[model samples]
Target: MAKPKSGAKKATPVGKTGAKPAAKKDKSSRLDLIKNASKRVATTTTKVVKAAGDAPAKGSKSAAKKAAPEAEQPKEKVSEKTAEKASTKKSAAKAAPAAKTATAKTAPAAKAATGAKASSGKSGSKAAAAPAVPAVEKPRPRATKLPPPGEPLTKREMEQLLTAGEGRGVMGEGSLKGRLVVLNEMPNLVVVGRDKRELTFLLQGPDQEVLPAYVNHKVSVSGMIRKTTNHGGVVDVRKYSAKKPEAEVVEAPPADTEPRLRYLSPGEVSMVTAAGMGAGIKGFAAVRGNLEMTGEEFVLVVSNGGTRQQVSFIIDGKAAAKGLRKNVGHTLQVMGVVDKTSGWGGRISAENVEPRPSEARAVSRDEMELVHIEGEVPTSVDVKLNHGLTVRLPEQPGFTWAIEPTVAKRVGLREANFEPGPNGGPATREFFFTPRNPGTFEVEFFLAKALAPGLVDRSFKINVTVKP
Candidate 1:
């Protein structure tokens, strides 16, 4: 370093003292140039940010233009190529935010696809990788329509009705038109539905009275039916009407053909007893009655409107036994001949035995005998054949009256009427029966006490003789 002279212009080193005024002025100008350039950049960056904020979530081209805002180049000027490069860098930066926003907008759709698989019990990674499609369901089978009412049921149709269950339109609901063939006139009406097939049925309600008049005649029957075992069932007849004769002959066989054996009425069979057994009685008799089986013996106790009688029969070996077991509560037709010593009583040889359709009505009070029974019972009581036997029982508390099962089986439960007593102790019970056969029966009456549980109170025995 050299020492400077005083009062003379010192040759000061450039770094030793402060810079020159002209040099300072040039520096200030350079600084002002830089400041202006920075201000322009800041203003352009603010404009770009404002444009991006105002744009939709899916952004617009305006945002991109604002991102590379051409900062008015400093008045000092710059190369065109360099300005283009700077603009490109700013454009890339702004495009990056738009791409991020687009990705964010599509995030819900991607998450929905992933969630579908995840709900289907798949792992998160697998759910995110693949998706599933929904499935469709199958339809059900259709139903079948019923056969025409006027036509007869074929073998297949009959079998279908026989084996039909709920929902099978086999014995389809609604009215059925057919020829009514009455088989028996007894405690209940029994008849055959003679359409394409002979369907046996028990007549019920007011229709029972209506059918007896039109036996062996063509008619239209309306009712509800519930299927039973075998090919037969019972009809709950609601209404019935007589069909025209032309309708009956529509499917009728040849006129010269031998007709089916006609069943006899209850009154006709009872008239047989007055005529007695003889050579002329060898003809077929269609008698209606209750069929009872005791060991090897088969007996029928027939009932007339005014009387009842017993008729024994020999079973035909050639007869079909398809529905024989279900005929206990049914009225049956015994087509046979009358003889003296065929069974325990007067016997009739049964050529054909089957369930018969009939119109059953209750016995009138005029044909009944009222007998009051109390503490003591007589040794024997006389009951006229076919006449109603009404036994009046006294009302007592905690006591019930019943006949023995065997006696009830031989006779019948018939009808029991219960009426309220004067002081409401219990009830006055009236039991009725019409003796069919001429025999001495030991009827056991049981007085059951409520306190004894299973034990019976007092048992009274009585001998009843049905007159010939």
Candidate 2:
């Protein structure tokens, strides 16, 4: 036969020289294959050995003998290419478990890692992976960022803005611009800027776990304001101080005609806070409330605001500036008997006023909207100013002692008069009147009873009737 082609099978070698190339090549390759297979198997065997204290795998020796008997089989049948492919398939099938095992090993190691090295590793991994998500949104804005208090406002500015009343300090948050301090250790820090327009701020620090603490005195604080789901935003406090000194007054039990009065009796200042809550001193919403005294003087300061106002009452028939603190901010409950006084600022008087129990304070976003009534209110007097007829007006119940004339001649009015009402006290005057004509007209009655800075400055209208 012709010499076999180079690409074809080699001829059987009979001599030792040729034996080196064919026999040695086959044996070495066989050994290499066994070595490679042993290595691959070692991966699994190593795990078993480590777990069981390095003992030989059960039946491994028997399996080795069985594999040796298969060596005589044509090695070409189990070619390297075929073995490699099988190994690759086996590896692919065990991929998940192999990775999991690696991770299992790493878990304990990862937990044991210490120092910034470990932390940095975790953070770096998180940072890299987290950035992969491209759709995370940003938070919305509430108000303009404000400089944290103490960081900005000087002590002098704070003192100048919030000092004792009576021209001593700028009018309560109305006049000047100063730092808004959300005080701690007061009754409640819900003190709104008192007005809508205020400084911009956002609550900066608050793990937001606990609320700030407040006690019975009016405290001052400075902080960063933040908007909260709460009607108003919460304040992040920085510095605070309680500012309730004391007052002059005596406390006695309530009188006979008064409502259920506690903590307050006669000759004491009744802190009228609400509009119509008729009750005792405890009626104070008790937010930042305290019963303090100063040498024969008793005072009840409110965290919401100072109770009892001072109004100028017609005491002793003299225009004296008196401090009147009664029935302010109340709707339903009328204050105590009006008493005149002297040595007070502006027009003021004292009355037995209590905390308003009925009126609920407006929260942050509540409708503080006011509905202005257009229709005129009926007063005790109905004046007709027409045909040049001026009549003396009749008196009313509370305003019997008329201080001004109530007669005039105008378009639809003919005449009017004023008379006294029931139980006119020494300081109060009451009156009632009649109109001679028929027409719509406006009137004013200075009840000589004013709790606010402005006296009984209410509006009244009269619909006069023409004589039939």
Candidate 3:
């Protein structure tokens, strides 16, 4: 059997969009773990550490009463107020895992220190000692030896080169010069020159003398040439000193030919990327945002002040990355090749774009049409629209006093829809719909509009048919 045709009204389009699939947001891995843990805790929550009034952690008791040989007043441990305090100890332990092993390895010393600190209550001593702790600065990966070459290399960088040399087993031989590029960050110094030759050398001592140089500095070098298919070509950089480079001027588009897009105001014009206009011509400006470049042809937005309209048009060539940015904003000017968007065909193109001064005042309009009328319109009555919108036929243009009913005694004329006359004058139209059916019937528009701020209608009616 044939399936019944769906009576559901077709969804009107906005910005050429269909009933888009509901977007499915990806679940964050971190948030997922947190949520799972939270859920588990919510179901099988354990000990609830209720917050007591703020006070020193674990309040002191009166030296433990001497009942039945009170245990020797246990020594108190030092408290670390913040998380940072533990980091120092943790780093120290990790640095020498073989020696620290476990808490048992140094518990005695730690316990003794805690006792001494607590007994003395010399908090200032601990604070002073903290400054002495060699702030083991984490090794930063800095591209070493970059300057006009006179200044010495930075400290951490010197250490890195020596460490690299030790790994390479060639400490002094690795002379860095020419177009220096870092390859690896660890073990040894593996770099390539401007010409693309590999240099794997090691640092014998902790010094900046082993690092490389770059910038507006030039160097003279003579070394074995090396080349690769995938990577490129280069000469082994060896034996060279830094020298200054000469200056030169750069070329650009002709001054007059170099046109720029000047948006009349701080607003945007956004067209669908598929609108067919990509980057316009290379030298000129892009097509106006009102034009819709598409796989087929470009449609332009043309509006005659009173009632005409601007339409989307397709011109061959690329379009700019600009268009109407805001849903309601107007396009002022366009220039250059408009790039065709990805997945969008490169067929339609805009040569150049310039926003017409008249384009300055673009507006969003709501076009509504009545499709059906429910119930009856009694003499001297007003109908409420489906969406609770209050609309009357005379309120719109080009339509007025069109419908005539036999049962209705009198029809009111409260509104009128008028347009511009073809001969350059104002045009007016009227419609007066009177009903005799005393039932349900629908009133529909003869045609539909294809433009901005689509009309939103929810049926209109007078409730004379339903029982009161």
Candidate 4:
């Protein structure tokens, strides 16, 4: 015990000052630990209170307290570090609910904003989204009226209606009315406008049968107007109304005579042209007239005695003798077959010809020299050379007859003398000549207006022969 080692515990002295000071130091430390623990527990409690205020229903507060009781019992042996860790965990859990609540509240605003943008797209575009509107229509103007019926269209009117181009509708399309003349019966029906400038038509449809009853008579015809190469109108008839003739001629002929072999009138020939010739007609086709050579055919010009209705017959061959060209004015009877095959209307294929019987009498040369043939004449005649020849001219009404003086001088014949028939009737003329030689001579006879001074007339050329 002399001197205790420095590292060993030493005994305390029983002094009042030393003991009081030691005890006081110990108390101060205790109080300081209590204060620190109290501060930590207060901080934890503040966090728990705030979490409950923010999200009381998110989790159970009792469970949080049971799991960590560091704040409830500050006297426990738990470490400061442990208490701090538990408080941190509680704060984290509480903060998680707060963050979720904030996120849930903000999500609806974001969704609402997105919906607004989508709705604007559907209704905002103008041209692409709008409905369509309908358009209104305009009306047209009417057309002008056509010309009156039965009236001949003027040159200007015709020019306006017709065209030089081919086809039926060249004369624009329309209806027309005019006088009808049926040119033929059944099978092929043809008609024409007698007063409407003789506009020809080709009759068709159910109304065609009614047209034959109106032949050579006046009637009103209605149909569609068309054109042809003949410059005549063609109608597709729909209806017709006939005006009865003033007089009707009914002729009953001998029985059993064939149609072709019977004599045909001028009107019949015209009908044949309109209807067309079926097969062939054979019989004597006789005509009395002066002969004329036209192209490769001979034309016989005739005038019916009573009516003076003129007609022409086309012959196929030449009928000229060596000196007969000068006798072309002399009348002769030509007999042959009349058929439609050769020429326009009808043709006479002459088989033989001779002077008319009344003019065929032979005269003695002495009597011919003494006779002064004048005033009127026999219808036709023949003569001998070195003797005078007398010709008889017929009465031709509604006509002024004449002969060329130059022709008489050229043929060595005396000038002709004319004698008119009684009471505004026909007129006649005679031709006489002393033949100096044997030959044929031709003469031209013409018809002209009574007072007209010009060559506006139709002529007949005849051939005469002087026998030796």
In terms of TM-score, which candidate is stronger, 2 or 3? 2
> Per-residue lDDT tens digits of candidate 1, residues 1-468?
766656778666878767677566854554454455556655655554445445543343445443443643432242333244443444334434444454344344334433453445446557678767577654322112222344344565554554423213344344555556655451122333322334554545444555667765566665554346344555556667775455334567788996554444454345553322221233456666665433233445453111112233434434424345445435678666544342123566666887876446466657466444554465677877777666666535644455654576565446544344444244555667777788888877666542122357776677778887
The TM-scores, one per candidate, come to 0.25, 0.24, 0.18, 0.21
Q: Which parts of model 4 are misplaced by more than 4 Å?
A: 1-220, 223-257, 260-331, 335-337, 344-468
lDDT-best of 3 and 4:
4
Give per-residue CA lDDT, model 2, range 100-133, as digits (tens). 4543563333233322344566688899888765
Model 1: CA > 4 A from native:
1-18, 53-62, 65-287, 290-468
Q: Pick the candidate with the highest lDDT.
A: 1
Name model 3 segments beyond 4 Å from true: 1-138, 141-420, 427-468
> For residues 1-468, could you state the per-residue lDDT of candidate 4 as single tens digits?
587868787776867345777667755655465556656655654555444444333332442444246444553522443355443344334434543454344334433443454355445655467866687654322112322344444554454333333234334334443444544343122333321233454555566655666665566555455565444555555556667656768887669885546765564444333322322443455656654333323445553211112234555534434333333445667766666542223466666777653344233445455334333322233456677765546534334445555555555464233344456354455555666666777766666433221433576656556678
lDDT of 3 by residue, 404-449 (tens): 1221222222222222234533332323332323334333222112
lDDT of every predicted structure (CA atoms): 0.50, 0.33, 0.31, 0.48
- In angstroms, how far off is 461's CA in candidate 3? 20
